[model samples]
Target: MWERNLNGKDLQFHLSGINNENFIMKDEQTGSWWQQVSGRAIQGPLKGSQLKRFSHDDLTFATWKREHPSTRILEPDPSAQEEYAPADWEAETAELPVVTPRGKSEPLEDRDLVAGVSNQDAARAYLVADLARQGPVNDRLGTTPILVLPFEDGKSVRVFERTAGGQVLEFFAGTGEELGRLVDATTGSTWDFRGTALAGPLSGSQMARMDVLLDYWFDWRTYHPDTDVYRAGL
Candidate 1:
């Protein structure tokens, strides 16, 4: 998600158009168009301006509620209930044709799901299916060591900087009683999906969470042509 406030002005936006399957938001204040993927204003008065990104998690309701028991869900408006997409929207959309002007099919299929990270002049795409099979992954992006954790459910995922207490840590999948948890190589500390060290020397320590965008390969590649594709053991 992106911050609507820019240059000390809170802007209101609405669906302006679609370009290459991405949403283009037009701010009411300046009439500028912003790209959904990059949050960059591409046209009109605020051309070249960027919106500050807000971090979010795309977790399953069960997982989210387990972690945040008191969280309140936003109820859909009753009047707009009929306007909402059906529960099969995703399945239906998968059969639709896609167009990507600046995307490649190599590395992954256009519609493959990917967990993308873009920071510090670097961008990378991690195949979601591979993440489910590989469990927690330890990798570095632009000098920042990171841990990518895929929950047991196989759908939800999270990324965090592995550096904690001034130490770069490596993590592996927990087994048996420790299943669904992460164990760091340095201290054997067990970490929950929240990136918090739950046991061992680093107990109570928290890994810095990083912003991740769960996107399709075509959309990610179209926006980040130079992005690297993560491969197992490579």
Candidate 2:
């Protein structure tokens, strides 16, 4: 997803009515068209401009409430009908038949949620299930030290650069009562899922944020075919 506003003005977008099956959005302000996944304007006055993407987490209402108790949830429109809801859960268990350009299929199921991270030309996808089993993940992307903190439920993740005060640090999964948090090996500081240092010498510090996307395994690999999948041995 991209920022809705641009250049001191809020821009409105609508789906471009194109014969191609690819998803494209057009801004009403400049009449420019954009690719839905990359948020790059490809046609019209705003061509060559890129949209700034912000990080987001998709999680259950209960989990969100526990983390952000004061946050407000927008209520569904009262006029909306039950038919507008999603299809049956059982029907979503299997991957849907998708037709894309030749040689685009990925190795994982289309419905599996993958936590995607990218740096320059290097990109990787960590299966949410594997992260849940392994706890925090300390890895690198193109020489940039990074940390992946997965929620306990395995449905969401938050990524951050593992640098503070110009020093790179390594992190590991917390033990015992500190299970949900991550502890840096160098500083022994514990960080919450949001990358905030909660205790220890570095308390109150925040990690530099990184853009992470949660998408179907197929969608990620389709957009980034060179992506490496995290396996048990990796």
Candidate 3:
């Protein structure tokens, strides 16, 4: 028989899809639900590490789909994991500072939307990816991923950071001009968006979210051809 330990202080949730196994319990620090939200270890004795936190990136989404027999492997509902991700990036670079979230404006709710996971660690994945794919980059961090079109080269799409403290993701990039046009088109504002959707920041999954976000930005132009915007093109 499998031994089970349940703490009365923390509520338990039986996640059925995870390898047909069970993972549950609430966080002691916060009473938020602790569901397996990220990818597995993939190696080591602890190789199948399940992310028991709400997440949106590829790893988490993939895990969520693999275990669940029915749920489609789509991006985690952006709102569900919005806290860790920012809601705005328009002023992320100019007004924000460092690579992390600071000041009182940063809310705990968004910081640990997924509970146990570290937003700092999640943000770092984005930084590393930017470094590898592109050669040399200038960015910090703030509420969202800042897209600095520093290069005139074909390097239009890049995940720029705001500062070095390592907290926010200014927003995704496709040249600074491209961003201006988007603002002109969408009145939805960054307020309604979160994580990669609104903030342009990457969370648990970096490349996965980055690819989707860029693809989405590009696809939007298809419908607004008459806007006369995007003359520069991505």
Candidate 4:
């Protein structure tokens, strides 16, 4: 009769009697000693022996004492000791929540990809910010940040406008003659003009205009996670 986490939550694990439950029942008349224990295997092969036919309470006591040797010398009755049950109960219970922080390196997607405005609407933000690896921000728009999002048409880059009380009144990343002009030039459901040439496919002029918008986003610090940073290198 063994419990894995006594007074705690765990499977009803069985440990075959490991030749440890040695009981000595003294015989007063014969002056002999009768070693008593259970016949059931608590663990191991049937090679071990414990005098079977013992009461449940007695068997429980023996296993308890075997696991916690200090309890062997002390009387088993809880009433005899004040708060004994509570102390043992607490010792048996698990308090701290089990959390394993190992190997949790999956890439986290940011729900707030639009930057300032979307960030405000989002209740929580998730981006792995680590200077040791991802490094400080580098792009056309900002510095030392873990995430960036491109501007969707009708939406300009927004830098948050905070008040004295730390309340955000609005967002204003930026808008300009160049920015607005490009917005008009591009055509897409998202107003994300890919800048294909009128002649066909992508031409030098179309690609050039695309670069201008990307530079604006980088300068304003509203980074598009989808955009490649390598383009700036050339």
Of the candidates shown, which would achieve the greatest lDDT relative to the real structure? Answer: 1
Clashing pairs in 1: none
Ranking by TM-score: 1, 2, 3, 4
The positional error of residue 52 in candidate 3, measured at the CA in angstroms, is 16
Question: Model 4, 1-234: lDDT tens per residue?
Answer: 322231233322222222222333332322333323323323333223333231222123444465457863555676667655574553343232323232233233222121221222221121212211221112332221112222233222212112112221111122453332222112211111222223212222222121122122221122222332222121
Q: What local distance difference test score does each model get?
A: 0.89, 0.79, 0.29, 0.26
Deviation of model 4 at 112, angstroms: 8.5
Task: Give the candidates in order of lDDT, highest first.
Answer: 1, 2, 3, 4
Over 119-172, each residue of candidate 3 has an lDDT whose tens digit, in order, gives: 232322122223224532333333444433322222223332333223333333
> After superposing candidate 3, which stretches have Cα over 4 Å from the reference?
1-14, 17-35, 41-107, 110-138, 141-234
Sliding window of 10 residues with minimal summed lDDT for model 3: 109-118
Candidate 1 scores a C-alpha RMSD against the true structure in Å of 1.7
Candidate 2: worst-modelled 10 consecutive residues by lDDT: 93-102
TM-score of each candidate structure, all chains considered together: 0.94, 0.84, 0.19, 0.15
lDDT of 2 by residue, 1-234 (tens): 689888877989999854233488999889999988788888899998888887666777888898899999988777885646375643564346555444555566666778999989699898887887787788888889888878877767888999886678788878897886788888899888888889988899899888888776767877787898777443
Which candidate number would show the highest TM-score if scored against the true structure?
Answer: 1
